[model samples]
Target: MSSVIGKRCVCRVEVSRVEWNFLHPWQRTPQSKSTGTAFVIEGKKLLTNAHVVRSATDIRIRPHGSTRRYPAEVLYFGPDFDLALLKIKGEQEEIDFFAENGKDHICSSGKEPDAKRKKFLHGLQFATDLPALHESVHVVGFPTGGNTICVTEGVVSRIDFLGFSKSLMLTIQIDAAINPGNSGGPALNSEGLVTGVAFSTKSHKKNQPLSNIGYLIPIDIVKNFLGRCQENPSTYALSPIIPYRFHSLENKSLRLAHAVPDTVEGVLLTSVCDSMKGFLAKGDVLTGIDDRKVSNDGQVQLRGDETIQHGYLLRGKFLDEQVRFSVFRNGEHVISSPAVLRYIPTICPRWESVDYFPDYLILGTVVLLPMSTYLQCQKGCGTRLSASTTNWCQKWPHEWEGKEGLVVLTEMFSHEVCFGYNRPYWRFVETYNDIPIKCLAHLRDLWEESMEQAKESDDRNGDSNSAKTFSFVRLGLEHSDDIVFEVRAAIQAQADILKQQHIPCPSNITQSNPRYKS
Candidate 1:
């Protein structure tokens, strides 16, 4: 175990800084330094945790024992997976190090390396197959900025779903002691091959200290992620199709006026990729796939397998594969075949000067910040009415009842629309244009209509100098000051209506609510 600890590990990474505000409203204090790690598989590219470089103003990667540091930048990121790819300049020393110790080299050197090539290969190669559960493992990285690479020894505790990232095969649970500085570091099997990237840990509660429950991003997923990056550097940042955010819509009793029982029961196709068009369109209620009947809740029941989400059944397959969807469109049950797309549509996390808010456009802009049981654990606090305003765009806990209300997490600023409205974190939006808002597709239509009206108004007024504005009607506890009664009554009325309609709602809300069952 000691021999497997640090000898074969070489992670390409940097030191990063993150800032969180404890006091002082709306102000991010200063930079807090944290260790970051990245490693290459198959010489394609690098991998690290999304949190490792989150909101980082500076990033500098240096080899374990080297004084020289190289500037690195983000290549791609899947927030849902908590993984990011980094692009760095290949210097002589770095290339030599990678050639010697990293995964099997795929890059062509201008000149051939003779058997006696003097490359200073520093990293260990990744193993081809996954290690069995309970296999001994070692982790290596510069945690807390020490003189040399720090190493921790443990064993794989679990190797199924981690229920964190939406990407398939993205996580691994280990008893290895992962610390704040150990994030993005490489986890190694006893054979000295890289296995996973260390990411998160369970927190200690009162009277209950946490144990070795560290999680890792499996090397296999990273390998797949890197391959995509290397193949297309320009679009490497784009993610594959897999959604982290999805709400159940198997309402049999609350069917639309003409929607049939089958249409009412299957999962509602609430949203699709913003960039990925033609593959999936919003409002297409998926009733079945590949000839299998999708349960009303958007799940596909297999012969003896556990009922799984239809999307999960489509996991790991490529775009262009013919997927038959039995969808209920406009009260008609139709089989729609959407083309497979490699690129996932997403709102770039980094804000851009644009007209559409990403998720809100797909789901309705009217939403409540998720106040589920899972959200509360992250914020380390209980639900308070005013907390949403202060923590807008900042991480906080939220609580809620079943289908409850829609919560807004992020909003894109497009033109002058929604200009005066402050983005509130964890705030719930109940309606749009007086209609009960449920998801992203509903919001997109509302926004489009508003834009059209604004355009018409401007045209009729012949005012070229003035820009028309659209109002984003939102109902929530945040506006409890002005529309307190209205929001409360709406909540109660909605609850009663849903109960009367026999619509199934979530039993409890938590950050873990949307997470996949491990």
Candidate 2:
């Protein structure tokens, strides 16, 4: 197939972004410029990798060989699958964007091809089915070498692969020349139909990055994502989560502990998903799912000969779908039943939140907010979370005591009341005034109650030695001593502390605040 079709539908994405600074929630990181690729899709929309436009402030799209740069906006972004759907900011029913009429596309010559001899592609079409191993493919994008659309040929080296966030998505591995600027481009097959989207490669790895080994969001997952996106435009539409977390029963000792026999070949349940509430337990060993036998290494055969992780078998399963499982529980071969799939989130919240602005709380010189998954996502985005606390933020969904979050004292500064106490930076606030602190909202409530008590109980009292006259708040922490401060002094310094720090408000207790919904 000619590269002309690719040049017609594909585009050069120019993004300028001012990324957020997790440590300094009030400020954004410096602006930066990057280029990638995208292709025209249905309904006047474009599709590209989510990371390409992440935190983007200004976005422009330049069609191949064209001087016009059209402004675009993100319609929907899916960080889990590394995809984003975009639409031109202006121009409704603008057919000229993809026009083949007297337009010089990809050809440097200032002449358009003869009308009867030319062809135009309205949009890139999905391949009817995925390509096979050793199938030749083309990668079209504006990579680092030059701005022109570069086409590289490669073969489908492997299939049914997974990457990033342990996403368990069906991916494609190719031996292609994928570079920095090639991200978000289309991977087309022999018939010029897009088989996948070139999203990432191994060259960005820290230790020993290599070239010629790139990955693609296979058509299977691509179609699945688009199918859901079509149901609800401009929303982070999601399918139901794979309803199980299994650990390999490869260790004989571990298997014996679960009272499993040598004849049994299955994976141990690290934690049962809440979606399967009463049907399964944490210690139960899963022998099979959907009637397919799982090996001790937690693999199941798919597509006849292809063997993939047990989780892959659950891919693309949407809401209300029944998942039958064969289980081993309580020293017997029991617990075989099906459970309906539901949208249950992991213990940690997803990073693709609609809330772009993070919430913050200021108490005197100390700054606080709830710990979130951002601690993990932005690898180099600096934060004060300790190693153990950071690890706990990555847990799967499970039953836990108390509330579901940790109120972290992220920042501490010099102040009269904060002088003698140990700096409680990044430590979980376990209690306030002998009352358990559940979340930032709860902490705000307790602060209000403490202030009301001070005003009514002791502002008029003459005896400073009375217990009621002790206007101080004690905050207990995990693995640290209590942080005690005089409530009156903190209140007096609150205005100055906030003013000097340039903080917007004393407390933005929830991420769901409509003010930060954008």
Candidate 3:
């Protein structure tokens, strides 16, 4: 039976991760241990949720009913999809034995087979079609209570787009109880085929407890993620957002204003991104995508019985691929040209690369860091600084594409040189030496240049008593109150300040830095 196959396929995964402290930016928190479930897929690979192994320093897997632990390496991870594929390391013989026997072999000599033995491992098959609502399904995994494989029966309650890990993706809501440790487990259909991967559950509100609200990454999304990996094995391509706000054109007044025909049913584009600035104008009616007719409510019929968001048609599309659209523009039905999909850089990047150290720079007592969603969350979200910075963070990348980067003055360590400045943390850096700052790396370059120029000027004058100085403008500060500092004095004091503060380095250079290449 497929249920029996699931029991043999499900495995327990343990991850040891070292999380970074956003407050300090460079320092890391103590190592932490977390457990989740994974199941074998094609190619002898284990599939699991990305969050299960986020920031993981080491990953180990124990197959069902096996006491032996095998090391595994992440081959592919998609933060947006919350999926990760792992290839087990150096346990081919043990894995093969377990695959054939469904348990660890107890040899007479109490010794496992050596490299001479060869065996085959089996993987679970995925359903070719989407599961229907109310279809019987089984949730298999090692839940929080114990390490034993557990199975629960349920029905597919609903299938829709739900927010997971800060991004909206297609999900299947099941009535089964999906608790901690169940993440990355497989949800199998009646035939024992994989329907989706168990992921998130809705939390209960105060005074009200929610039930049977677990969500799974739908099979289509899983397939899309796998296909993307196969296409580009070297680089991870992020899925693009629609880049437009949609509104229903069911109202007669809006329909008449846009000149949409009565026979046409479509949604009105309220706003568009800068990339689509001229090609697709606001107030244009989107009637269809790839020849699929869209409903007034921004939905399209995916199949005979399934109607999904019109955006679903754009899923798994590469950045270079173009999508055809039918639109009502200027009171006429037009077949619009193919528009290529592209990903926009966001202020808050996904936490997929949590293992990486944050890029930061320290000058004298002031700590300069780039503004990110992670940083905003670490600091109070409701604070005046957070609120003000969030507005700019939400702005599309195209709005400031020319700018190299956006950075903020995050912290100020007390020093005699910066005595009366009363540094405002979270204030955006507008300019350095009256020149508009590009990015964090560019800011560092400007600082280096300013210091060198100041030194040259002092040398040209041959004035040993004169001090070398540089100045910068803060976004909210007045021009007359520019923050100024003596470059030579600050440089002299940097070593002492860093030692006193127990800082390992003055800055963590990023790949984007030109110095990194050199």
Candidate 4:
């Protein structure tokens, strides 16, 4: 292990967090503390994992051997790629962290004069190329069980590739002992330069036999992530995908069914975004990308003795970049001009969504929440949703419309207004007062309007005791019978339920729920 790389480049990240309490919608979890590793990079920014700063209220940085900590802010928290960029909050102020006489290299022990905290003398440089398989590497971090920085050794075991922007997920698997608090640390080569960033370990579950197997986000992914950050200089990084799905044409019968000649070998385009409907179609044989010829198994030559999936060629490219794709359709080999792949919507948006707090609305005593990947993982949640609706979009994911989302009737307070209706804990709400429900906000608006209309209807009836008896609002549900509640009684039940439950708000929404657009 190189002493200079660990001591000078890496810094310990301390995070103070106050997370949302999903179980109790209106409340927040207690403040908690966590630590991870970050290293200096070009532009005076620190690089680390997004999970390190998740739900963070305050973040501080302590350079190796320094007792003082400096406050910092996240520049880009890319949860999609599990990476983040940060800088000292007061960098605009007198940034004496680096002395005036400091050297340009990151490993330099540039001495500071009268400074309370040590300055980064230099930023770590990325390797010009990826380390070959079996190359020994050093993992540096301030892992748990110790306060000082710890260095571990490992060998690069594998590097796999596939997909468009998602190809960036193809990380370097290493036989390293990566543990809690080691996240975002750099994997250094013999020259002590950064080759990869430590991100994950295989099978983190207890009782699992997996050990000595960790993964590093390689330089290519780091560079690609940094490149996408330029699209929005002040926000978190997100993976912008190209709407393309290619399947292997490995089988003889399958290739023959697609009308491919015996001499031709390439992958088949199984699905693409609606924007590509006229240009490409399902079952189209994809022959090449630019000048590179694709193989039957969807692989393409990277160079002599090296091969990668054809989509890897497009990994570094931006979403707006037009790619020259060659395909065989209707018995003709066509060389098409550049086509800028479009953004497509997903059916179950909750899966891998980056929301710090999810959007939810309370209708009287009923809780209306949107379906998401995160919601599906909690408390046997996968079964909470009706399989008929959840499976429809999943089975034919391409059929899911843009801006479409599910609004589930996930909860109900133990009030007399909803006493007769079955719990239907995770059933979806399809309509309100006979009007279709679009999203959580839309459902809220409908309920509010229905209450107002019910008030108007009561005014026309003029103070009759019978009129107070039953003006109703109906909520339709999937996999359950309609829930009928007296309008005025249900609205009053909301305040009663909140008071009894110690909830301050009727809903947990800060923004109009974001829908993945077409």
Number of backbone collisions per candidate: 34, 0, 1, 4
| Model 3 lDDT-worst window of ten | 471-480
Candidate 1 per-residue lDDT over residues 1-518, each given as its tens digit: 25421333345455556443321112354766666676553343456787787767677766554555666777665454577776555576456545444233223764543332223143346667655667888887666646467888888876654355434443567887787767888888876678887887866676453787888877766666555555555553334455322345644454553355542556665555443345346666666766788776656663354454566445533433456666677777787656453533222122111111212221222222232212323453336533652343221112122222244433222222223445444434555556665543454455456555655766776755455343433443334321222222333443554454343441212231111111
- In Å, residue 412's CA in model 3 sits off its true spot by 0.8
List pairs with backbone clashes in candidate 2: none
Q: Top TM-score: which candidate number?
A: 4
List candidate 4 segments past 4 Å from native.
Answer: 1-6, 91-94, 100-120, 162-168, 204-209, 235-237, 302-304, 350-356, 373-376, 382-398, 401-403, 467-470, 512-518
Q: Write the per-residue lDDT of candidate 3 for residues 1-518, one digit (tens) a residue.
A: 24444566688999999977766776888999999989888778889998898888999888777776778888777777899888877688546634653434334587754422222135778998778999988888888998788888899998886677767788888899998899999998987789999988887775443787788998888988887677766656667776676899889998887777898889998877776765677788888988899899888886677888887676556666798878888878877788887776665444525312377777766777766634534544336556655666567776674674566676777778778987445666667766777777787777667567766877776765545344432322222255677776666556667998898988875663221100
Question: What TM-score does structure 3 among the candidates reach?
Answer: 0.87
Q: How well does model 1 score by local distance difference test?
A: 0.51
The per-model lDDT (C-alpha) reads: 0.51, 0.73, 0.73, 0.72
Per-residue CA lDDT of model 4 for 233-258, tens digit only, reads 64433454545678898898987787
Score candidate 1 by TM-score against the native: 0.52
lDDT score of residue 418 within candidate 4: 80
List the candidate numbers ranked by TM-score, top first.
4, 3, 2, 1
TM-score of each candidate?
Answer: 0.52, 0.86, 0.87, 0.87
Itemize residue pairs with steric clashes in candidate 4.
Answer: 97-119, 350-372, 350-373, 351-373
C-alpha root-mean-square deviation, candidate 1:
14.0
Sliding window of 10 residues with minimal summed lDDT for model 2 = 509-518
Estimate, for each residue in 186-233, the C-alpha lDDT of model 2 and write its tens digit: 998998888999988864558665778989988777777677676654
- Residue 280 C-alpha lDDT in model 2: 74
